[model samples]
Target: MKKVIPYIASNFKKDKIWMRRTKPSKRQYQVVFAIDNSESMIDNNSGELACEALCLITKALSLLEVGEISVVSFGEKTELLHPLDKPFSDNIGGSILSQLAFKDKQTDVSGMVSFVVQMLSHSRNQSINFSENLQIVFVISDGRFSNREEIRKFIIEAYSQQQLFVFLIIDHPKNSNSILQLQTISYPNGKLTCSPYLDNFPFPYYIILREIKSIPEILADALRQWMEMISSSFL
Candidate 1:
């Protein structure tokens, strides 16, 4: 008892031993997903693959507990499957999958982009400096849209708002048409290069997937690279 008392008294007086203080993370990551639900997605089982990819993404985000995600499906009209205000959970995959279906005949890219832009704009209006917010919108489609010019206009608007748009084109491995279209739409005269892994981008970026099953891993890797890029910029 005497020995314990002396040790306690010495520690209190010296104030040497204590738990380390840690600061909370200031970085905010907001991800928005726009999936194509047109008839083409059903033909190649693209719809199913997209659902699987979304499930995997939610699972990964749940595990990391680093970011919040919102999902929307677009065809003739836009449908919001998940909203940002809703908290993420591990078992929400099944619920999400049950809500998605490929039934619409037309791909409404412009409508989807406009909706996402408004959502981001509203969120930004509430904050003072949104520089810490990393806003990324992932569009999973077969590179087919109803109106090309409208889509281009919205893409520029998104860039002006400092939002990065990633187009994940669902096509065969040998096809390059979608890649070329993405480059042209995002950068008319500017030349953009992309590989299978999707690296290096001055403006918006894209990825061409041969197999639908690889969407989860590829998207996860892309997010990791973006995070690393942001971290290094601070150093």
Candidate 2:
């Protein structure tokens, strides 16, 4: 416990490493997640996957900055599991595990994105110096989102504001009708394509995750992305 104290004191400011989608700073760190918890995803252990992924990602973010996380779960409908810009409560992970493991609904990527954007916009507005804040949003799903254009539009809009948006589409049997297939349609935008295995930043970054299925892998990828983002500063 003695050793941990000084570490906490020194690292408390790590939260200052905030990224409103790019450039990790050591303040105002927030993690926004728009998760698809439809029955299918749950059946495929996506709920468990979510639990693992969230823990891993949050741990990585914590290293650079103390982070606040909000989660929005969506299906044919959407509900806020955690409100945007709020500090994480105790045992929050257990609450999320129960929700994701049991949630039933339809896939509505657009709706989820809309909810995320609204909440984030509100938080950003409340900030007098949004330019000084850093935040990252994660949109995780198992496919079959209903609105393509709307999701695309909001992503572009969020990116314009310099907020990092990640679409982690883990494949499952229920995704049979999933139209998020990359080959059939172009990704986020022509110039803004991305992969979860690595982070891409044209100017900053937007990650579209696919194929990754484990916590360690997720952590590696996330940490790599962070390193890439920080390293870009030298060039």
Candidate 3:
């Protein structure tokens, strides 16, 4: 039989050891997610898909122990569905996701950008601890704008902050003649790239329905994958 060493146990209080190892730190990050809710979005048949995408992102972000997220939606007008000054709430995420189906009658990208600028400005002024990581603004749209000048100003301001990560989710090719020029001009510095169109876009459903009918699932999966890539790179 092999001889075994006698076991040793500590008598020092358990509470002291637990406190030493599990003391919480003040290292939380703020991630702002800005989504579009314009009239065109309603017609794209992607409202539900967009909502699902937002839900997935929110869910994924919730997994991070030191990160906080804010959700905002925009169209001809902007609304702060969830504020950054508070902790993440599942109820808030669900409510904001539901708004994807509530469309605006007009499409105004400039208005949306303006709203984002104002939100960021306020956040900075409030001295919120966004950490040294990044303050992301994920813009999910088809790249259509009404006031190019306003948008330009917004982009310049956001980029000047040097902490803004603009993720443009271009789901489809521009079909509007009025937006064609703006599309070419608004492309960010090598940061903007085209991704697959969300399956719910009404244009392709009739043709592709027989093959894959669940548009929400497809788009959600793509968005989730994109978000996972972002989280892995950042977090």
Order candidates by lDDT, high to low: 1, 2, 3
Candidate 3 per-residue C-alpha lDDT over 17-39 given as tens digits, one digit per residue, 9 for 90 to 100:
33333444454455677777876
lDDT of 2 by residue, 24-97 (tens): 44445567877777887766555555555565555444444455678777887778887755556547756875
In TM-score terms, which candidate is top?
A: 1
Q: Pick out the ten consecutive residues of candidate 2 with the lowest summed lDDT.
A: 196-205
RMSD, candidate 3, Å: 13.4
Q: What tens-digit string does per-residue lDDT give for candidate 1 at 12-72?
A: 2323332233344565667888889888887655676666556555555554445668888
Best by lDDT: 1
Pairs in clash, predicted candidate 3: none
